[model samples]
Target: MRRAPIIAVVLALAVPSLARADIQPHKAIYDLVDEDGAATGGRVEYEILGNACDGWAVLQKIDIPKAGARVVTTNASWEAADGSAMRFHETTERDGQTVSRFRGQAASGSNGFAVFTDGEGGESFGQLPQGTLLPTLQTKTLLTQAKRDRSVLSSNKVFLGTSSEGALPLEITSVLSPRASTPGDHPELDGQPSWNVTSSFYEAGGRPDTGPDYTVRSIQFGNGVVQSMEITREGATARARLRSLDLYEVVECNR
Candidate 1:
């Protein structure tokens, strides 16, 4: 079984709330750690912009400093407000040298169909399965289930281009429950209603009974902010702790 890097998990995680009410636009910073709970001398900077009218904009940066090398990935993405389309560009750098770059887009037809294509050849890479969703819609679906007191969160498929080899569809299942009280460096999130979300990922078309390729545990706030998260794959764990947060007020888009 193969899995994405720990930091890449943060890239695929979505933070924005639903439309109209409680739409959160914010910046979150986190400190990285390894399986033994030791600091990794790296950090993650995740930002969300745009609103329901213009869709969601995301920019994520991961920087990890090793003994003699460094790995960094900077990704920028946007999803349509109608949950019908998305576009993304990503770059990965190692030791101050860029090693990889790719850009792609996904769109649904008027008949409720979509495809995700990559590379500069302008060809259809693959036809995504029905009910596939990008970040904003993905979060909305989970939050909706959470509000309805559903513990077993389900998603048909998710396309995040999270794979190092290339973009791939992934099947996600999560359990949502009330979060226990936890302290954080940010006061605004203190005592806020939160949920303990644990998600498991399987290959898009694989049988879930065979077991998940990886798992992620996170504390998600009502305002669509994440307090902390851990990724465990094959017993190797990586964690991210909230270091700082800056929340932005949702604004109206005047036509």
Candidate 2:
């Protein structure tokens, strides 16, 4: 799921070319595509923020080409991608009551995050973790403990560890280019503006031994709302795509 976070970043686009000031809150649905430019039956949801923080929901399905028989939140981020001060609190319920809570703050160049999870028995933050410092292009960090994969925070750089056990090197695949606006009465259904974006990821950064080039196609906003995205290897047998079907308002934690 290395493409997960990058999908969120796609939704957060403050087009440097646009003259608009205030960004509208919106929700968008994206159509995922493969390397061959075919639909992959995947989707994403982007919740544009009214404040400094934005929200994302990702779903990759199975069994059916367009739907998932097994689905878990692959990843979620409630941070403002524009590098502003922000805070977020998230709660989940299984049968009725709250089962988890996540709260954090991001101020200018620095940010903090924490998570509290509750099982079927009860809720607790006993093992919750915390971190300080907002993730950035300069703050390249390893997100997973696995030795076979590499994921980083920067946009233009790919840092594969010294010991990787893969046939191909996973280099920086895509760098987001300028956005093209959405036209007509559609208004992107997500309230926020829409755009067409592309990223070019390399095989040399992590898969130096592999042949061919791979890229990702995405639609997003500056506040971190990814409408849709897809990932495909140059010549892989299967590629995955994600799309979002609906969007609704959630509770605001600032109160």
Best by lDDT: 1
What would you estimate as the lDDT of candidate 2? 0.34
lDDT of 1 by residue, 1-255 (tens): 123355666446555547544657889888897766577788999888887788788888999876779988888888887667888777778998887666777765433333334334443366666667766677777776676674645655776655432345678777888766655436878755678888887765567888887888988876788877898787777798888889898877664
Best by TM-score: 1
Q: Deviation in angstroms for 151 in model 1?
A: 3.7
TM-scores vs. true structure, each candidate: 0.86, 0.39
Candidate 1, number of clashes: 0
Report, for every candidate in turn, its global Cα lDDT versus the true structure.
Answer: 0.71, 0.34
How far does residue 146 in candidate 2 sit from its true spot (Å)?
36
lDDT per residue for candidate 2 within 7-114, as digits (tens), equals 333332211111122233445555445667576654444444334233222222122132333222222334343433333333333334443433333343222222
Give the least accurate 10-residue stretch of model 1, judged by summed lDDT: 110-119
Could you report the Cα RMSD, in angstroms, for every candidate shown? 3.0, 11.2
